[model samples]
Target: MGKVTGFMEFERLKEASEAPESRVKHYKEFVVTLTDSEAKIQGARCMDCGIPFCNNGCPVNNIIPDFNDLVYRQDWQNALETLHSTNNFPEFTGRICPAPCEAACTLGINEDPVGIKSIEHAIIDKGWANGWVVPKPAAQKTGKKVAVVGSGPAGLAAAQQLARVGHDVTVFEKNDRIGGLLRYGIPDFKMEKTHIDRRVEQMQAEGVTFKAGVFVGEKLVEGGITNLAKESISPKELMAQFDAVVLTGGSEVPRDLPVPGRQLKGVHFAMDFLPLQNRVNAGDKLKDQILATKKNVLVIGGGDTGSDCVGTSNRHGAKQVVQIELMPQPPEHENKPLVWPYWPMKMRTSSSHEEGVERDWAVTTKEFIDDGKGNVRAAKCAKVEWVKDEATGQMKMQEVAGSEFEIPADLVLFAMGFTNPAKSILDAFGVEKDNRGNAKATTDGEGCYRTNVDKVFAAGDMRRGQSLVVWAIREGRQAAREVDQYLMGATVLPR
Candidate 1:
């Protein structure tokens, strides 16, 4: 610990952000990074706890105390090194990971947790500015070929690791861009695309080839999953050409509400609406982009995706935005004694929610009301309560007797989370799936991450179902180690 008693002396300071009214006017990153002195104080707040549960709390197990100490001592470069040693993209996680590590911090039990995410943001941004982040090409070539499907966080981490270890890695992305979700799913207001672009340049310099607009499956995916592939590759061809194949595609199958009037023209999935705006922001002219302008927008689902919808709708100059959740609202604050050192269920308000939105919970949509022109006009909803069934000993939802209502809505976005990965890719590779429709793969023991088909592996969301980007990176790095061992009979890569 750089400063043993610093935690007791310093107070937590949040990163400054653009005001809600000012930030919603455009699509760009609004949160300003902590200054050098501010970051040092934030880092100094890390208590010298005996056991660093923050490390375990983090999905990628970042060396929190070490980095905090380094930052506190003004060793910025070493802090960046420690951060990159665990997380492939601190910029991504620092911006959108929700900071589970902070929730598990010892200081959080009694006081505000250390601003670890802010320190990380400062370290990475400083690293890039000072040219500390650069290409780390391999010392020697292994002469082995690897194919990574999906260019999201997981696939990118795996490809970077394998490439650094002297293997020829080619990443296949179905979209015209490299980053699968980071490029399209996340709004630019949260993180700019330049971050992903620079990483692509660095990976290319490290000898990792990126083939965009190329689908690596027998057939192209349809429906909600975006597939801008100009070419398709068969599984047999990929197996014959590459020594190993890793499936790191995201969970793209969005959960749908199969209520009445679901066929309305103005009702769409969040994916179908979000990516268009991103593409437009990237200077891709879209002919028929979905707009929330001058419309009363209804966002169903109360997760990050729904919050994102709220932000985007506000940016589009929407007339009004109302977000609803089927589940009851959680407490504003969690009971720390009961849920310490673990993620707790509580009311979370995002920057999008702060902009402007009418938020409601425990309301279920019964149907999408249709206008005369086959467009969504409103949503009929009802309040519901969770009651325990004595016979079954399970909680079930029941609608209130006289709580039915309707809200005006010209645009309805289904922001409910994704269910599973596209079925076509897994079926093409002959990989088995678990009961949840995710690719069946273990995380420990022998031959971990290997799929049923020979030379085929699964990782990230494809294997673990829909999850955080940090988890995706962890699985990707682990899967790379497994694939390397399988090929070279040994691996120096970390798990």
Candidate 2:
């Protein structure tokens, strides 16, 4: 550690964001960068623990202590290198990932954890500003060709790793843009697309090719333009063309609620609503966006996805916004002794919650009520009680009688998480899926990331179901090593 007793001397300080009222008016990032001195002080807070749990706490297993020490010593170049050693894209994770590393920080047992995310953000941003982020092309080509399906974080990570290892890597994205959720699902106010753009440029400079707007597999019959564009390619060709094919496609199939009036108008998936706004922000004109402007928006689910919906709605000038969750409200504070060094259950007030939102926990939507015109207007909901099971020692939820009520809503967005990757893409590649509908791939096992089909592998949300961006990066890097080893005799890449 740069400062051995720094943990005892300094307190945690992080980058601050603009006030909710002010930031909600614009779609640009609002976080204020920390001064050099402030960042050094924050880095000094990293204790020289014999065993750094923050590394284990991080999904990508970032070298936290090393970077903290580097920053404390004012070695900016070394700090940036340390940040990039594990994570392929720190900016994305820094902005969006729920910092489990901080949750597991050694200091978090008594006080607030080290501002690891902010430090990560600072390191990478400084690297970019200093022109330290440059492409490192392989000296020799491995003569291996890899087709990484999906250009999200997982695919991006895998593509970059393979490219660095001298494999000819190409990332295929179905969307018009490269980033999957990062470009579409996420609001620009949190992270602009320029961050992704510069990285794409660096990856390109490093010899990784990106193919966007090319939907692989069987084409949809309903859409116009029946003729296959040479521009468009088939899964059959991809199978024969590449030495290895890694499926990093995200979990696209959403978890739908099949309550009565499920087909009612003005009810849509959160993904459907969020992407359109992103398109608008990206200068692409969307004709009939699922606008929440002056609409009574009702968002269902209480996860990050739901929080994102709340933030988006508030920016859209929603008439009223209400969120519902099936689970009971968590305590304001977690019992540190029980959940230290692990993600604890507690109430989390997000930036969106602070913007404006009426939230209810332990509430279940029974049915969507509609106006005579066929547009959704209200929903019948019931509050539930949570109980614990004796045999399994598991928690269960049960609805209470006489608790049903109605709330008016002009628009209802299902912000529930995804169940699995779309079956079509998986079936196209003939990959085996687990009970959860995620691709069957073990972290440590023979044929890791290897699908039933030869030369096909899977990782990230496609393999792990819905998960954090950090986990996706970890899976992507691991899958890259597995694919590299499978292609050649062995791999020199890190796990």
Top candidate on TM-score is 1
For model 1, the superposed segments whose C-alpha errors exceed 4 Å read 221-225
Writing each residue's lDDT as its tens digit, candidate 2 over 1-495 gives 778888889888868899999888878999877777888998999887888899999989999999988888889999998899999999999898889999999988898888888888888889899999999999999888999998889999999999999999999887778887778777898889999999999999999999987777866423311111235567889988999999998887888999997889999989878878888888987568888999999999999989989999999999999999988899999999999888899999998999999999999999999797888999999999988999889998889989999989999999889999878778777778899888887888787888788898999999999898899899999999999999997999999
lDDT by residue (336-383, candidate 1, tens digit) is 999999998999999999999999999999999989899889999999
Please list the C-alpha lDDT of all candidates, in the order they appear.
0.94, 0.88
What's the lDDT for candidate 1? 0.94
The lDDT of model 2 is 0.88
Q: Model 1: which ten-residue window has the lowest total lDDT?
A: 217-226
